[model samples]
Target: MEFYLFNLIRWILNIYYYILIARILMSWVPGMERTPIGGILYRLTEPYLSPFRRIIPPISFGGMGLDLSPIVAFLAYSFLEGGIFTVLRSLFHWVG
Candidate 1:
């Protein structure tokens, strides 16, 4: 039961990561606001991404534009999943 809880938490976090990644990709393209699901994903992701955007501005590729903040967020997620989460799992396994 406890293991299931841990897995659930991890799964939720992974979903967040996927949404964040999607938001990053969506930024380059317009018309995201036209879709209901896209609107929700944008709303869910903007709060976290905005703060990072303030710190790290987007890079201009000639007439094209690409933001690197999502990559940073992805790295952050990877670190949390690979480092702290793994440590917590090991601890939980040991304890229960």
Candidate 2:
């Protein structure tokens, strides 16, 4: 039971981590609004991202554009999910 819970937690973290990356990358590419699949991906990602937009605006490079907030969020989450978890695991020696 404990093992299953650990696995579930890890899976959720990785999924969200990847989703955040995917959504940010998708923004750089064109045609996300034109296709159905792309639209759905945009919809799934936008709700979480929209709130951050106001807090952290996108960067502009000449005519091109980039958003660094999602990358920042991913790095932050990675530390919490990966680094912090490792630290806690070592500190407590709780899991095998």
Candidate 3:
């Protein structure tokens, strides 16, 4: 039971992590965002990203813009995953 739960949690995290990476990659390809799949990805990622975007606005350097929200978003997700894994591991350890 615990093994199934752990794998499920990791799978979910991996999916979200890939989605986030895909969102960033999609931006570089012109007109990608206009496609249906791209739009769906945008919609799914935006809610979580918007807050970080607001907090860390794009930094301008020599007329080039760098969006840091994605980096922050990934870091935040790592923290969340770590905490979840820690709790679940302790639970399973106690039970076993």
TM per candidate: 0.77, 0.68, 0.88
Model 2 vs truth, CA RMSD: 3.4
The lDDT values for all models are 0.76, 0.70, 0.90
Best-to-worst lDDT order? 3, 1, 2
Q: Per-residue lDDT for 49-90 in model 1, tens only?
A: 787778788788897656787778777778877775667668
Count clashes in each candidate, considering only residues at least 3 apart in sequence or on different chains.
0, 0, 0
The candidate, 1 or 3, that scores higher on lDDT is: 3
Clashing pairs in 3: none
lDDT of 3 by residue, 31-83 (tens): 99999999999998989889999999999978977888889899999999988
lDDT of 2 at 59: 88
Worst 10 residues of 3 by lDDT: 87-96
Number of the top TM-score candidate: 3
Better of 1 and 3 by TM-score: 3
Q: Ten consecutive residues with minimal summed lDDT in candidate 1?
A: 87-96
Candidate 1 off by > 4 Å: none
